[model samples]
Target: MSNIGICEYVIGVIHDKDIWYYVGRYDANGMKLKPNEQYSSFLVDAKRYNDEDILREELESLPKTLTYKILELQRCPKCTKEFTEHPALSREDNETEICPECGVKEAIQAYINS
Candidate 1:
Protein backbone atom coordinates (compact mmCIF):
# COMPACT_ATOMS: atom_id res chain seq x y z
CA MET A 1 0.00 0.00 0.00
CA SER A 2 1.12 3.54 -0.73
CA ASN A 3 1.81 5.93 2.12
CA ILE A 4 -0.68 8.77 2.46
CA GLY A 5 0.11 12.05 4.19
CA ILE A 6 -2.00 13.40 7.00
CA CYS A 7 -4.30 16.32 6.19
CA GLU A 8 -4.98 19.43 8.28
CA TYR A 9 -8.39 21.04 8.58
CA VAL A 10 -9.35 24.49 9.81
CA ILE A 11 -12.51 25.35 11.72
CA GLY A 12 -13.90 28.87 11.84
CA VAL A 13 -16.98 30.74 13.00
CA ILE A 14 -18.31 34.20 13.68
CA HIS A 15 -19.07 35.20 17.28
CA ASP A 16 -20.04 38.53 18.81
CA LYS A 17 -19.32 40.08 15.38
CA ASP A 18 -15.77 38.68 15.33
CA ILE A 19 -14.25 35.82 13.36
CA TRP A 20 -12.04 33.08 14.81
CA TYR A 21 -10.47 29.92 13.47
CA TYR A 22 -8.91 26.72 14.81
CA VAL A 23 -6.65 24.24 13.04
CA GLY A 24 -6.89 20.47 13.37
CA ARG A 25 -5.17 17.45 11.88
CA TYR A 26 -6.59 14.17 10.60
CA ASP A 27 -5.80 11.10 8.54
CA ALA A 28 -7.67 8.70 6.25
CA ASN A 29 -9.49 7.15 9.21
CA GLY A 30 -11.28 10.18 10.62
CA MET A 31 -10.97 13.64 12.17
CA LYS A 32 -11.16 14.78 15.77
CA LEU A 33 -13.15 17.99 16.20
CA LYS A 34 -12.82 19.41 19.70
CA PRO A 35 -14.11 22.94 19.71
CA ASN A 36 -13.17 25.27 22.53
CA GLU A 37 -16.01 25.93 24.91
CA GLN A 38 -15.00 29.55 25.27
CA TYR A 39 -15.68 30.34 21.63
CA SER A 40 -19.15 31.74 21.19
CA SER A 41 -19.99 29.88 17.98
CA PHE A 42 -18.28 26.57 18.35
CA LEU A 43 -18.23 24.98 14.88
CA VAL A 44 -19.37 21.49 15.80
CA ASP A 45 -20.62 20.65 12.30
CA ALA A 46 -17.81 22.22 10.33
CA LYS A 47 -16.55 20.12 7.44
CA ARG A 48 -12.98 18.89 7.14
CA TYR A 49 -11.13 19.51 3.87
CA ASN A 50 -7.68 18.26 2.98
CA ASP A 51 -6.38 21.27 1.03
CA GLU A 52 -5.58 24.36 3.05
CA ASP A 53 -6.02 26.59 0.02
CA ILE A 54 -9.51 25.21 -0.55
CA LEU A 55 -10.35 25.68 3.12
CA ARG A 56 -9.19 29.26 2.97
CA GLU A 57 -11.31 29.83 -0.10
CA GLU A 58 -14.37 28.34 1.58
CA LEU A 59 -13.84 30.46 4.71
CA GLU A 60 -13.41 33.56 2.60
CA SER A 61 -16.66 32.80 0.84
CA LEU A 62 -18.49 33.14 4.13
CA PRO A 63 -20.31 36.31 5.14
CA LYS A 64 -18.30 39.48 5.52
CA THR A 65 -18.77 39.32 9.30
CA LEU A 66 -16.74 36.12 9.37
CA THR A 67 -12.94 36.07 9.32
CA TYR A 68 -10.34 33.37 9.80
CA LYS A 69 -6.76 33.08 10.95
CA ILE A 70 -4.52 30.06 10.71
CA LEU A 71 -3.55 28.63 14.09
CA GLU A 72 -0.07 27.22 14.53
CA LEU A 73 1.91 26.40 17.67
CA GLN A 74 5.32 24.87 18.30
CA ARG A 75 5.90 22.81 21.44
CA CYS A 76 9.07 22.25 23.41
CA PRO A 77 10.40 18.70 23.23
CA LYS A 78 11.67 18.59 26.83
CA CYS A 79 8.64 20.05 28.60
CA THR A 80 6.06 19.17 25.93
CA LYS A 81 4.56 22.63 26.36
CA GLU A 82 3.05 24.61 23.53
CA PHE A 83 3.86 28.31 23.26
CA THR A 84 2.68 31.07 20.94
CA GLU A 85 5.54 33.42 21.78
CA HIS A 86 8.67 33.48 19.66
CA PRO A 87 11.69 31.56 20.81
CA ALA A 88 14.67 33.18 22.55
CA LEU A 89 17.58 34.63 20.60
CA SER A 90 19.70 31.57 21.47
CA ARG A 91 17.30 29.28 19.68
CA GLU A 92 18.16 28.53 16.04
CA ASP A 93 14.64 27.79 14.81
CA ASN A 94 11.84 30.32 14.93
CA GLU A 95 9.12 27.69 14.97
CA THR A 96 10.11 26.14 18.33
CA GLU A 97 9.80 28.06 21.61
CA ILE A 98 11.66 26.74 24.61
CA CYS A 99 9.52 27.99 27.46
CA PRO A 100 11.23 30.18 30.08
CA GLU A 101 10.78 27.60 32.81
CA CYS A 102 12.41 24.90 30.71
CA GLY A 103 15.22 27.23 29.70
CA VAL A 104 16.07 28.06 33.31
CA LYS A 105 15.94 24.42 34.34
CA GLU A 106 18.22 23.44 31.47
CA ALA A 107 20.64 26.25 32.25
CA ILE A 108 20.94 25.22 35.90
CA GLN A 109 21.36 21.57 34.97
CA ALA A 110 24.12 22.43 32.49
CA TYR A 111 25.92 24.57 35.02
CA ILE A 112 25.72 21.86 37.67
CA ASN A 113 27.01 19.27 35.22
CA SER A 114 29.90 21.53 34.22
Candidate 2:
Protein backbone atom coordinates (compact mmCIF):
# COMPACT_ATOMS: atom_id res chain seq x y z
CA MET A 1 0.00 0.00 0.00
CA SER A 2 2.93 2.33 0.65
CA ASN A 3 3.87 2.02 -2.99
CA ILE A 4 0.55 3.63 -3.85
CA GLY A 5 -0.11 7.29 -3.20
CA ILE A 6 -2.22 8.55 -0.31
CA CYS A 7 -5.98 8.03 -0.52
CA GLU A 8 -8.12 11.14 -0.41
CA TYR A 9 -11.27 9.35 0.66
CA VAL A 10 -12.04 6.37 2.90
CA ILE A 11 -15.23 4.60 4.08
CA GLY A 12 -15.52 3.94 7.79
CA VAL A 13 -18.24 2.67 10.11
CA ILE A 14 -18.47 3.74 13.73
CA HIS A 15 -20.08 0.69 15.31
CA ASP A 16 -20.84 2.22 18.71
CA LYS A 17 -22.92 5.00 17.14
CA ASP A 18 -23.91 3.01 14.08
CA ILE A 19 -22.67 5.81 11.90
CA TRP A 20 -20.86 5.62 8.61
CA TYR A 21 -18.65 8.42 7.40
CA TYR A 22 -16.08 9.25 4.77
CA VAL A 23 -13.03 11.31 5.54
CA GLY A 24 -11.98 13.51 2.65
CA ARG A 25 -8.54 14.66 1.57
CA TYR A 26 -6.92 13.52 4.77
CA ASP A 27 -3.21 12.87 4.28
CA ALA A 28 -2.07 12.45 7.87
CA ASN A 29 0.27 9.88 6.38
CA GLY A 30 -1.55 7.70 3.92
CA MET A 31 -4.91 5.93 3.41
CA LYS A 32 -4.69 4.64 6.96
CA LEU A 33 -6.63 6.34 9.73
CA LYS A 34 -5.08 8.27 12.63
CA PRO A 35 -4.10 6.18 15.63
CA ASN A 36 -6.86 7.66 17.80
CA GLU A 37 -9.52 7.23 15.16
CA GLN A 38 -11.35 3.94 15.52
CA TYR A 39 -13.99 2.31 13.39
CA SER A 40 -15.77 -0.99 13.72
CA SER A 41 -15.23 -1.45 10.03
CA PHE A 42 -13.48 0.54 7.35
CA LEU A 43 -12.61 0.21 3.70
CA VAL A 44 -9.71 1.62 1.73
CA ASP A 45 -10.19 1.14 -2.00
CA ALA A 46 -6.90 1.67 -3.72
CA LYS A 47 -8.77 2.16 -6.98
CA ARG A 48 -10.73 5.07 -5.48
CA TYR A 49 -7.82 6.49 -3.50
CA ASN A 50 -7.38 9.51 -5.70
CA ASP A 51 -10.84 9.45 -7.26
CA GLU A 52 -12.49 11.92 -4.90
CA ASP A 53 -15.58 12.95 -6.86
CA ILE A 54 -16.09 9.56 -8.44
CA LEU A 55 -15.86 7.81 -5.09
CA ARG A 56 -18.41 10.14 -3.52
CA GLU A 57 -20.81 9.70 -6.40
CA GLU A 58 -20.51 5.93 -6.20
CA LEU A 59 -21.00 5.97 -2.42
CA GLU A 60 -24.05 8.19 -2.81
CA SER A 61 -25.62 5.65 -5.15
CA LEU A 62 -24.67 2.73 -2.94
CA PRO A 63 -27.70 3.03 -0.66
CA LYS A 64 -29.88 1.88 -3.53
CA THR A 65 -28.12 -1.47 -3.38
CA LEU A 66 -28.14 -4.05 -0.58
CA THR A 67 -24.44 -3.96 0.14
CA TYR A 68 -24.49 -0.85 2.29
CA LYS A 69 -26.73 -0.45 5.31
CA ILE A 70 -26.49 3.34 5.25
CA LEU A 71 -24.51 6.03 3.48
CA GLU A 72 -24.44 9.09 5.72
CA LEU A 73 -20.82 10.05 5.90
CA GLN A 74 -18.72 12.97 4.68
CA ARG A 75 -16.42 15.23 6.65
CA CYS A 76 -14.17 18.09 5.76
CA PRO A 77 -10.72 17.93 7.30
CA LYS A 78 -10.60 21.61 8.28
CA CYS A 79 -14.10 22.00 9.71
CA THR A 80 -14.89 18.35 10.32
CA LYS A 81 -18.36 18.99 8.96
CA GLU A 82 -20.36 17.54 6.08
CA PHE A 83 -20.02 19.82 3.08
CA THR A 84 -22.56 19.68 0.27
CA GLU A 85 -20.81 22.02 -2.13
CA HIS A 86 -17.50 21.48 -3.84
CA PRO A 87 -14.39 21.72 -1.71
CA ALA A 88 -12.18 24.82 -1.61
CA LEU A 89 -8.44 24.99 -1.19
CA SER A 90 -7.30 26.65 2.00
CA ARG A 91 -5.58 29.97 1.42
CA GLU A 92 -3.40 29.35 4.44
CA ASP A 93 -1.51 26.52 2.78
CA ASN A 94 -2.93 26.54 -0.75
CA GLU A 95 -2.54 22.80 -0.77
CA THR A 96 -4.84 22.01 2.16
CA GLU A 97 -8.40 21.82 0.89
CA ILE A 98 -11.41 22.42 3.12
CA CYS A 99 -15.19 22.77 3.04
CA PRO A 100 -16.85 25.70 1.33
CA GLU A 101 -17.91 27.23 4.61
CA CYS A 102 -14.42 27.16 6.01
CA GLY A 103 -13.06 28.46 2.78
CA VAL A 104 -15.43 31.41 2.96
CA LYS A 105 -14.52 31.99 6.55
CA GLU A 106 -10.86 32.01 5.73
CA ALA A 107 -11.41 34.41 2.89
CA ILE A 108 -13.40 36.70 5.14
CA GLN A 109 -10.71 36.61 7.77
CA ALA A 110 -8.03 37.33 5.24
CA TYR A 111 -9.99 40.25 3.85
CA ILE A 112 -10.60 41.66 7.30
CA ASN A 113 -6.98 41.33 8.27
CA SER A 114 -5.76 42.98 5.12
Instruction: Write down the RMSD of all candidates, one decimal each.
Output: 8.2, 10.3
Q: What lDDT tens digits, residue by residue, belong to model 2 across residues 18-100?
A: 44444443344666555234232333421223466776675675433323232322356776664334578999889876778
lDDT (tens digit, per residue) of candidate 1 on 1-114: 121233446455545565544434332356543444323333333345667788777666545654555433335565665433344422334454476677777667768988
Off by over 4 Å in 1: 1-50, 83-85, 88-96, 99-114
> Looking at model 1, which ten-residue stretch has the lowest summed lDDT?
1-10
Best by TM-score: 2
lDDT of each: 0.49, 0.52
Residue pairs in steric clash, candidate 1? none
| All candidates: TM-score | 0.35, 0.37
Q: Model 2 clash pairs?
A: none
Model 2 earns a TM-score of: 0.37
